[model samples]
Target: MAGSKTATLYRMVMPDHLCPSGLKAKWLLEREGYTVEDHPLRTREETEAFKAKHEVSYTPQAWIGDKRIGGYTELRKHFGRKQLEKGETTYRPVIALFTMTLLMALAAAWVATGEPLTILSAEWFVSFSMCVLAFLKVRDVESFSTMFLNYDLLARRWVPYGYIYPFAEGLAGVLMTAKILPWISVPVALFIGTVGAVSVIKAVYIDKRAIKCACVGGDSNVPLGFVSLTENLFMIGMGLWMGFNAFA
Candidate 1:
């Protein structure tokens, strides 16, 4: 069946410009083990003529035998793929932010104590990551709150908790960063983290509901699973550590 499959890709590749979506369409067809008949619409006239001939409004048109597949997005759908035009979410944003926060913590630690990595660097990493996550939540609290309400037990019980959660996180992060008032910071982090972990567990494991996590706020695409659960667990650990160190 693979050997019998053939695809035709008509794309725009001009002297000064190449249509990215067009290039992507061609790659997709070739990657799928299809014999691709590549056609370049190099000029405005050629592109218009092709579009008119195929009754298409777009340049990146694909054809499998006699079937016309639309653009890059349409071709992905045709091939049974769930992805963004660029790509699907793989917790990349969360990973990038956390990695950068860790680096920042190391840099700050190096400046203060002449050491790049130390026990304190972990503390800084948690605090800085919390601040960044809080910012994502606060950016669109309405959206974040809406997504949170879907699975957060407390948010469902008390709608205002959704609105206040971001502020509470930011406050805890700020306090943690300054290493001041451990009493306030520890409890805040502990309370929120516990609730969040429980909510994620119940939603994802117990109820087996697939849902979007509001970890990075309302605009997030992060799924409720290992990564989200780990985030809450980290907070719980941080809160306990800070509390122990504060009195110890």
Candidate 2:
């Protein structure tokens, strides 16, 4: 099918700049089993002339048997891919964070106890996840605070709480992970987690005001909903379990 089917691709490859979209388009065409006729406009004048002739503003155009296909995005659509939209909420960031943390936790358990599936692994997973999430928020506190103000009840009331939240989470995570200073860690985690859970519930479930989640970070496209609620619940549960071990 590759050699039999053919595609004509026009892309830009200037002395100073190369078009990434052109490379992506070529890769997609080849992946879809099409033999490609690549035409690269190596100079500014050539690129402009090519564009003027085609009556198109963008490069990396494709043609299949005399039928003109647009740029990389259009090519993706031609192959039946869901077109990506700006500001689309996705769980990919949280999913990736959790997946990486789980693996790290398992590795830690294996190193500590000579087994991967120990009780300590679960604890490590949650703590590691919390630490990473906190780091993301703290990386850009100003941005996170602005987004957090959108739905967090406490942050809305006291703006400083938004800035403080990340450090508090990181502190609790560090103390919990090290299994030291449980008295401080447990209370901190419990208070923040409880507040977060209530705020998420009120905003998403009760009020139904759709917004972005500041859980992963300020710049993420993760939605303010179930995933955020689950993160808060995890922190709450971790706090309770640790408290029982320390106090009860």
Each candidate's lDDT (Cα)?
Answer: 0.89, 0.95
* Candidate 1 C-alpha lDDT tens digits along 21-56: 988888888788898888898999999998898788
Q: Please list the residue runs of candidate 2 whose C-alpha ends up more than 4 Å from where it truly belongs after superposition.
A: none
Off by over 4 Å in 1: 1-53, 59-89
Please report how far candidate 2 places residue 64 from its true position, in Å: 2.2
Per-residue lDDT tens digits of candidate 2, residues 1-248? 67889999999988888999999999999999999999998998998999899999989899988999999999999999787578999999999999999999999999999999988999999999999999999999999999999999999999999999999999999999999999999999999999999999999999999999999999999999999999999999999999999899
For candidate 1, what is the lDDT? 0.89
Candidate 1 clashing pairs, residues 3+ apart or interchain: 144-218
Clashes of each: 1, 0
